[model samples]
Target: MSAPFRDEEFESAWRELDEPQLEGGWQLFTEAMGVTIYRRYDEETGLYEYKVLGVLTSCAPARCADVYMDLEYRKGWDKYAKELYEKDFSGRSAIYWEVKYPFPLSNRDYVYVRERRDLEVDGRKIWVILARSSPETPWDEKKGVVRVTDYRQSVAMESNGACGTKVSMNYFDNPGGLIPSWLVNWAAQTGVPAFLTDMQKACDAYGDYQLRK
Candidate 1:
């Protein structure tokens, strides 16, 4: 995953996004709080991961992006995050991010490149952002954390003509430790939906949390 943005990995991801789900083969993991979750096996590469699609009725595309890239905002909603920040940026959009997990689990982090683009389809502007984990920056030890390299996530949002956004995310991560498969499955199924709920709530308050000039 050391490749830079727009490289082969990203190119492939862009194409896959056109189809996002693996068609009728993708199993429905859960659907709640307006977020419909799906899962599939990818044992050849990483563990079981989720592909989530839903609508955030309270936010616009810009607000969604703002909440995602703003690390401080995450602290207010992302409960699993013990520590989160971006540093040692690769140019302007790619950077290193560290995440400290909670107790009983090894902390894992990521290096992701943020790619954004706007598409015009049928006279409508659609915005998409993909923040994918890149290994271009070498992994370094953080006293009590385990480095997680196998992580990928992307978001595509299009306005729904009512100020809301239709969003989708393809995310997967491999926690490098002795954790059981069942536990990993449980965490993904439970954590992702909760994350989305918190995200939607945070997005509702984005304007209030805007940084002052």
Candidate 2:
């Protein structure tokens, strides 16, 4: 069970973010906390894919990238995470995450692979992390939880030059179940911004956390 994505795939995703015409099909969904979210209808899944762009006023790009990759630190900040861990799949490591939904809804879990890249395009530094759901995992589905089968997310970050980081993210997923469309859309519009705010808080405290470690 090697990684399903290649380095070229991540590079291509990052390049797409840099393209000026990439926003053509996406419609503005919401704006909050310096982030603007856009959504586009996915014909294949009848779901919406989100594109988020913002400037995080909390930390530098490098620090922000480091915070994102630190699983131990994530456990403390991400309140919605019920179960999160990583295990080796063949020679590659993959993540297992179970997210807590509202009381009446069943929790959703995901098995995914992620990779991070540090790149410099024309002297501007960029940090990119790409993740996608994988079917090759040793875990089995739990009775009380629903497994998310089609999930993909990519984030690109660079310095904003005022001690902040500029971030661009593309996210899509289908939480398998009979959830209403409006509820799904509402969650994306709100949850994504809240997650960014939490991430900034985590980034702001990462230095202290590392010192203690």
Candidate 3:
């Protein structure tokens, strides 16, 4: 479980990735309406899952964004169909969004990224961090369907300085169609954008309060 120690090929490819590559990846993601990323390896269950996250940053100030997807794992993908996702928070609720999952396996290949723009909110710039993750999944060439079974959560954040973060995510399921094509598109256009806008509003209000307090 956990992708066979990330294999030699994967290790080599990952090693080749530098900070520039990471920044490029961030830039590409920000520019796209959304994208589908496929991988094969679930270390915990020995199954593969497909994961997708979408974005509509062009409508940032509008706060109209969406993100969502499903996880299918062969080991027990069917068993996880009815499972639910959640967000966890505690302490200093006004300053940051703290989240976690009850099940440990839900933690893997988590992608965290965010973008910032100068806004009129109290005449300052605040950064937002949108986060997402899916249990790693290995593709099944024979069946042509990736399987996954895991829970995931997303959060949003904003910073007073250059280092703070904002995060959030949108997720859904479509079992019959091989892959949830429509859901992916909807998430890119609807879920992520809306939630991100909410995060910004929250940030502006909270940031002002924090500054005053």
Alpha-carbon lDDT, every model:
0.69, 0.85, 0.29
Q: Which run of 10 residues does model 2 get worst, by summed lDDT?
A: 15-24
List the candidates' TM-scores in order: 0.82, 0.93, 0.26
Candidate 1 per-residue C-alpha lDDT over 144-195 given as tens digits, one digit per residue, 9 for 90 to 100: 7777777777677767569787777878777678877776766666777677
* lDDT score for candidate 3 against the true structure: 0.29
lDDT per residue for candidate 3 within 1-213, as digits (tens), equals 132122332222222211112221132222222332222334554433332233333333223221121111111122222323332223111111112212422211122222222222354332222222222322222233323233332222223133323222223222222334454444444444554444344434443443564
**What RMSD does model 2 have?**
1.7
Colliding residue pairs in candidate 2: none
Query: What order do you get sorting by lDDT, best first?
Result: 2, 1, 3
In model 3, which runs have C-alpha deviations exceeding 4 angstroms?
Answer: 1-27, 30-148, 153-180, 202-213
Candidate with the greatest lDDT versus the true structure:
2
Per-residue error at 205 for model 1, in Å? 1.4
lDDT of 2 by residue, 180-213 (tens): 7677866777888889889999999998999999
Question: Model 3, residue 131: displacement in angstroms?
Answer: 10
Q: Deviation in angstroms for 113 in model 2?
A: 0.5
